[model samples]
Target: MSPASPTATSAIADGVTDDALKGLRRWNLGLTVLHAAQAVAILVLGNGFAIAVTSTFPEGPPGADAPAPSSLFEVSISVAIAVFLFLAAADHLVTATVGRGLYESDLRGGINRFRWAEYSISATIMIVLIGFYFGITDITAVVAVIGANVAMILFGWLQERVNPPGRTSTTMLPFWFGTVAGLAPWVAIVINLAGSDGAPGFVIGIFASLGLFFSTFAVNQWLQYRQVGPWKSYAFGEKTYLVLSLVAKSALAWQIFGGSLAG
Candidate 1:
């Protein structure tokens, strides 16, 4: 019997670590693809249908009494979706390239860049929501939309700075705050829908779908905090957070802008 050499033992440990990194990279890439696809789907389905429906409406009379046609909300939503799709695609393309060979430093850099991008986009969304809120006269709906956007912006800022997965301190504050923030968009959507008069069927359906996504995302955040089921690894946890953040914000934007158009 002989003892294993130090170099050989180190090699074995390194091999295991390398394999783990590869797995994480693959997971990240997959999530990125999913995010991009969701953005495209929203644009194609939502905007396509909107254009088709609006085209059916006859042009208004030239007289001053005729209400001017407004497509501002629709255009705003399309632009938002296009921007998000671009960001997701570009970010993930960089991630897929840099993520190779499983270099931790490079991986971390990419993730941090992605987080900053997310933060910027979230802030932009809040601004857009503020504009939409002011455009409408529904007080309750306005408050809910603004509150939800503010909560999400705070959540994004804190999540990036706090790095909950890497911290040992209690995450109770972030956890509860994130949970509420994630649910806020859905609540706002429901409030809007309830107060809406004669909203189109597809519009109602879109709100319902977004509500479900936000609801699921809120639960997933809580579950990740608890480390129940598959939320154990930092890699898995962060990936979930990224995907949910992208989905929730994008969907919320679509809902808010689309709802405004409906009004």
Candidate 2:
């Protein structure tokens, strides 16, 4: 009937937390591998289809009867990226378990800064696909969007739990970026659905969605490193890469949209 000391209570809570995380990690690891395999299979098949379609229909819209690379790549890539994202989510789920259950501190936690880098890069690739889609009308672009969106949501949730912004000026960027990026596509989609097709709604949707995805992705990774200790130590080079990727894609997205309009 003795009252427990605050220190003792904290330790007990930590132990319980650790056990829970361990279970989650085990579950996530298995799921992650499963998702990865599925993604690979899907992408391989989709790419093959793209080759077939491109060869079969080299000019304008496929004759209602002709095969089209556009459709093949679009659908195939979409499925591939979607599967990849599902696999990525397994990382968060697994990492969370590692951080909470296995590691005592941030350094030892399941997801280290490098892991964040990988996630950030993958997210960037997804956003880039959004731009590519505008130009090529292929599955790769669609799948990238799908994968990016899924990763953002899952990782965003993990960020809150494991790397919550601790009232730092620098930390605000990721939260805001993620908030905007995560919401942009949904907003654009709604707007496009309401707007007329010839009104250039698709173009607007593509831009908003891609911009939001990349900007948010950069912010998310920036925030991850910011929490590691000092902002000065954060990876500036990686940020540059992310920024360049976005810039490159933005131009391509615009060009694609322009081509569609001119034709």
Candidate 3:
């Protein structure tokens, strides 16, 4: 990663201490193993998530036979979940293997360039899977959903760019802006679900659990920036993220495993 701008020192200088470094070191290894193990379990146990796009047409002329549905594309939910898991694991692994200097610099900047870079791809895929579960198949619509999520993550990166740790609280517009951008897909998903009859129990679980987890992630960022309570320590937010990543990825993977792969 490139050097963090000089604009990131207040939080690091005040929030990162000897105890915090020790804590970060422990979480760095723990989270790596946590994500890696979950990804491997999904790979070893689950076959794959099967998705076929089939359209049932409305009533047509009685004299003609309706056209048959065809599959547009097939994707493996296992792969999608695993991608998210591995990207998170890779983020932690970098600190262990590469050294924490870059990681610390990222904290100094109030953004982990590594995390956002991976989330841009991994979280986008996770949201795309959510799109599929919501019964969205139009190529254009799917692309739009992907764009929305990526834009949301880009806003996260922009949080650091526009207002680093050293920046005054008044310049924190990017953080709120990112939160708004993050809600775009959830709004779209809720809209879709509202029109449908219902969803499967496991599908609902996937949506609820992941949504809550993602929202919690944004909260972590918010607290860290606001210097609220424990979040006054940047390391506090880092640990929370580690736990959240583990829980979110594990919850999603296992839900899919139990739902579709048990057979």
lDDT by residue (79-177, candidate 1, tens digit) is 555566556656665656763533344333222445445545644454344334323323344445556656665664454344322334434475467
Q: Model 2: which ten-residue window has the lowest total lDDT?
A: 1-10
Query: Weakest 10 consecutive residues, lDDT, candidate 3?
Result: 1-10
Q: List the residue pairs that clash in candidate 3.
A: none
What ranking emerges by lDDT with the best candidate at the front?
A: 3, 1, 2
Runs of candidate 3 with Cα error greater than 4 angstroms are 1-13, 53-70
Clashes of 1: 0
Q: lDDT score, residue 152, model 3?
A: 81
Deviation from native of the Cα of residue 3 in model 2, angstroms: 32
Rank the models by TM-score, top first.
Answer: 3, 1, 2
User: In model 1, which regions exceed 4 Å deviation?
Assistant: 1-17, 27-76, 98-113, 119-153, 156-169, 179-186, 241-263
Residue 258's C-alpha lDDT in candidate 2?
43
Tell me how many clashing residue pairs each candidate has: 0, 5, 0
